[model samples]
Target chain A: MSQIDEQLRTELQRQGVWVTSMQDLYNWGRKNSIWPLQFGLACCAIEMIATAASRYDIARFGGEVFRPSPRQADLMIVAGTVTKKMAPQIVRLFNQMADPKYVIAMGACAISGGPFKQGYNVLKGIDRYIPVDVYIPGCPPRPEALLHAFMELQRKIDEQKLTGADKAEFLKPDQPSEFPVPRFGRHDLEPRANPNVFQPPVLER
Target chain B: MSATIETLEAMERPPVSMASRLQGELLEVSMGPQHPSTHGVFRMNVALEGEIVRKLKPVFGYLHRNHEKIGENTSYLGSMPYTDRLDYFCSMTNNWAYALSVEKLAGIEVPERAEYLRVILAELTRLQNHASLLGFLLSDMGAWGTPLMYAFREREKILDLFESLAGSRMMCDYMRFGGCRVDPSDEWLAQAKQIAERFPKFLDEFEDLILGNEIVIGRTQNVGKLSAELAVNAGITGPMLRACGVNYDIRKVDGYGFYPRFKFRIPLGEHGDTYDRLMMRALEMRESVQILKQAFAQVQPGPVMNPKAKIRAFRPPVGEAYGHIEAPKGELGFYLISDGSPNPYRYRVRPPSFINLTILEDMCLGHTVADVMVILGSVDIVMGEVDR
Candidate 1:
């Protein structure tokens, strides 16, 4: 019965009626092995560290392999307030990361500039510049909340459609040519390439 | 015999030209606005001549959240949580400092019991901050996370107590303008006392593990010297200054809260090198334990906040006040100007790390590149505090 079951399964795979498509396998592999970059910008970074520590143990979700280098990481957990000064570097790091990469903006600051929203220096939201896959909200969200975000990212990956070559722009096999890196001006990051989009309204008398 | 000894010293050192003596070109190295060892986005631009560092410059503002500016924008009560992000490690002390200034400005009085509670929580914050400082110091020393994890283990217990009382772990935001947000039960205080009693034992074990080790000794001793005179002139306060044998703790001088009654020694270091800074933190934790024990005993049953003061709607007269405390890092001060308004006329944080970081180049010169990490770790500048 064991041998027959094995042969039947193999034959089923050989025919059109199989376990799953190569796309599903690829998605599954990418989803489970989501390696995050070791990046922290502020108070939330402490919570991130606690999550990685013994008690919370992010290793359970396969995110324990925190790559210090962006080149090796498949995910970026922007763990704190991304300020105007730090925004360019954050975008640069995102640009450096390889394909099939995902970005999870993980805190109030990352989500919508947080308690420091009134502050001029803090960026309004990370998603305003780079594309954000998921956003976790809290004034430095608890580690469990971040873990939940990771789970949501996993679900998002599981739900992706990848077949017939009509792929999502983000799902394209080729690495993005370049993320428009912002340059520092007098007060803020000027995405000069996309001028009109980010320009503030001119005050009228 | 003196002439012969002088002749021998001169023979040992060949008289070389000053140009030849300083021959090698210096190499520039940027440690971080983002790197593992700089301890949260602090940048140290260094000039290295061969292995030895010729100059160092600390560049901050990467993690600046515009804390002072935001403080001015928000109401006095709204600024409490922002203080938590100041040092990020010593949230309790930061909250207390901010609250103390607001209380002074508004002429609001905190109840007697609230002062004891503040002392109790402040000591606990010191314990945890110093514990994690040890962890980070050892991590910077390249022991990876062995001692670091042990320190975190001890810190986790203190954080658990905080989480139960304050709702958040790192950013407690529990302090109010009049008093505090929550008062722990008898059971909670008893448990906190238990943890405080157990801290000294953990400190002892921690010291036995890494304090006297040869590698720690070699890397730390007689390295990154900041003389007591220079420390005073540079406005360096807290453990870094105290580590230089200057017993200038604000708790003792200003005698804030119940610090006057408590019995604790101001631990000082002879050399003020990296080793002394590490040892000073270890010693300070013991002092905090003693203070916590006293607070646990003396914390009497009374009202937590003054009945006269309305917390939600507080408006102060036209005046300015500066409230300061011996934060675990250094002297954290909050200067507030009130023009009889709910919002402060101007809000300023005299951040310890930001001021303390001015001496980085002074400390790092004449040491090797590796010692740069040692010195920076010794300084213990949280990028949040420095840039804020």
Candidate 2:
């Protein structure tokens, strides 16, 4: 099917007709009902809960169904400090989640270990293991920040192409659904970071 | 009819060999690290005889980020923000506990107005902590979301108060060694007074909704019963200790902060069961409101921070001091050993949630698997504090 012209589509809609593509319809359904995996690692989890509660009411966006099980979830809000001890389990949980899953690293800690970055047991960032789609920066970002991240995720989902060279990451058969779960090594997480998922820039001085 | 009678007789006579085979075999079940009801990354290893928990061992260190070690490495002032994440629910109390220890170590005196602000903030923290805890406990018992939403609705009001005064909702790093970071304006004080006055009405509504409900009573009453002797022996403090009819509140005992000036009663419970523990928090929230009212009324205009206290490069003299407070959960104490350095030589946190878990197994042993969640919820262990 050819792309509908904006003017023509508006004219048609005025004349009691509507125009939409299969991709648009699919993305519309997927974007609105993104079910987050109900998992919390630390303080950010409280803010995440506040976002879901009455005042913030995340259900307004149809993303309030926080599934306790990974299989039922489409979004993983890694909402707090990801310690080295919990990193393996978090990765395993990410692997357990079905295809077409998105991750929102919802705090400074989840993004780069935040204030506890200097701690021996803290994970540098969750992106070292599983790929994160959105990163919210705060010790524990306010609920409004989380809501903004949710909307940004929705926008990303809305823009996902069904069939094209620049399609969604999950759409590509070559893209791996499961990443390697890190192990607790002598001093740190084994293989400190995943080469496939995380690529840190090297400095030459 | 004869065949039916024979089958009934067979059913009455349990299979002797089968019973013998199953008698000594116990099933071990690990309940967390990712469980929604564990209230964080808390885990329990349970050895079960059928459905009853024969043995329960709580597994820790899932969320441990080496907080104490980090405190030791960081400067005295640098660690204030870190303390906010300790309980996460009651950051004000955590701040007070840490600041109290640092002050004792350095022989610093808190300003008069700062004491009033601290009292008010701490009480507000207690109100929200206990209120939200009940909601969480109920959620754990399977009445999910509605009670939690109601609790958070009220908690948001308190959080908004914190945010306006300190500029952060949850992580309010508003306390310093000798005083609070920000002084509330007169308008802010008026708003706080309003919230304090309105809190009891919400509590009344909350209690009316859940207190007399048969399901709540059935699930919590007589479940996870901790004896008074065992409670004291295990060093259980805070509402958990008070729930066992113990009158050992750190506020009353230590008489630190301007609590002696405030007229409030510690609500004690007769039975140390899950129900009593739940009620203990509710009653304590009421007491907190009373304290808030008294503090707000007595708060006078004065400098919030002490003039002599330095923030940037705070180096205390060589000494050690342990300062504790009646945190919403229990006795939140901070121990500091300073060696005339900006950073403390030793920094240790006496986390109530960690010590309170000593009796977790004892309370959960005879209870069913489902009861374990309720008991754990009543105990209210935040993983951040417990694992830290």
Candidate 3:
């Protein structure tokens, strides 16, 4: 008690109040209940099924329950190649989801279009339209790899200690950044004087 | 049998007027497009008469991504991965069939080691698919999760082997035109051998679990009995045809790769019923184990992929070829036409499941609507391949 009082007095002198009883409830909740939306588009969907099945058991991390609706889901596991035609739909779906949602772009197609990079229909990357929290790099990332993504998300959640009530603002598509564009052209250049009188003098001579 | 539509019309007097008048008597049921048991996005328009199916017309194209068209558009190397997506549950077999066809077109030879590995992987893929399909059949029969879980557990071990060897799991795309993607690493070889070694005991356990069970026999035996004539007419092959007492295995008949070198027995069935098909798959799994064991013992470690071959945007000489394999389902054939381009001009998949559906009406004619699902499951159609 005497030591606590002495430490409290020193801390109080340096700062205002030492409130040391704040529990990491926000992080814990975010870590334990990351609900992924059911958004499978192509071959990666098979691997996604394999991950959710008994062998990989994605349920162990509490994220195996896939929510069909985006509004209820906290995570979006994009499991396949998104075509150009499908990109707007994906963006619209992401926009419909509530705030505080994270995205894990699964497979190379979602990451950077994989082998279909040159294909006219394939999107270059899903991240161009929707923000990705994690990128699983594989042709179709193994189920265990998907689990690692979940674990990484958990680690991120813990590190950030993000509160449920945090009112984070989303950036608009047209909004300019705070950083200024570099000015290469200067406004200090002076205009040159004309030499028309010299030519007239030569002609007179 | 003739088409059910014609038969129903024949039954009515002044058919067109009767058809117009007697519309609501048939109970319409939409079975799929999202129903998990259909194996993919297939929709069945079943006209039923009080739980007895009168006519069932299969509707497809829900999962059709124009895989064949894409195959036509992409080069030989580029098209390899797309083959994996067709009947994705048994991707290695699909990969080999396509690769074999392309290899045939190019007049390329696969090395001995690569051939052995192909056989080993193809057999393993067969075993796993049959086991999984059996489990699925059981699920359709109301033995919900136990059998499916057991099947998946075995599948996981195989997939693990695939992952360690191929650098990817489900969609392996490991087969190249002339050879495979890579030789088996020492660790992978050891693991594959171990899996083969451990498989017989697991198969015995599987037999004990379901084969002797009275409920399984009662549900499956003498159900949907298709004679050898009917099976052949319907273009059934692989285990389904062999089960009907026909010894027409592509490996034995065509003598592909080192299949002629390996000594094995083909399992046959007398009745060609659902029980026979289930039993056929089980026995084939055992045969596959033997093939795997033989391959492991005989195979010499060497290059897995093709050497002195540059597959980048390579065009084939103008020709047409149909390559068929005795896949786990039936005869899976690729009819390819090359116009001296990087890609095939026309690509067609002679899907065994789709053709096998030719006999479905015959099987389901007198059976109940409940048995219809069972029959469909027994056929084991992969809609990706079917619609493609």
How do all models score by TM-score?
0.89, 0.95, 0.74
Give the distance in Å from residue B259's predicted Cα in candidate 3 to where it truly belongs: 0.5
A best-first ranking of the candidates according to their TM-score comes to: 2, 1, 3
lDDT of 1 by residue, A16-127 (tens): 7766556667778877888998888988888888787767778888888888788999899998888888888888888898777888999999977898887888888887
Candidate 3 docks at the CAPRI level of incorrect
Q: Evaluate every candidate with DockQ and list the scores.
A: 0.56, 0.86, 0.11
Best prediction by TM-score: 2
Predicted structure with the largest lDDT when compared to the true one: 2
lDDT of 3 at B377: 85
What DockQ results for candidate 3? 0.11
- Model 2 Cα lDDT, one tens digit per residue, A47-112: 999999999999999999999999999999999888888999999999999999999999899999
Candidate 1 vs candidate 3: the TM-score winner is 1
- Model 1 Cα lDDT, one tens digit per residue, B1-388: 3543553343334324322445756566677766777788777766667899865666678888898888887788888888998888889999999999888887788888889999999999999888888888888898886777787788889999999999988889888877888788999999999999998888889889899999999999999999999999889999999989998999999998789999999999988899999999999998999999988998888888777777677777899999999999899999999987888999999999888888887788788999889888888878888888
Interface RMSD of each: 1.2, 0.6, 4.2
Ten consecutive residues with minimal summed lDDT in candidate 2 chain B? B10-19
In candidate 2, what are the lDDT values of residues B155-235, reduced to their tens digit? Answer: 999999999999988889999988999889999999999999999999999999998899999999999999999899878
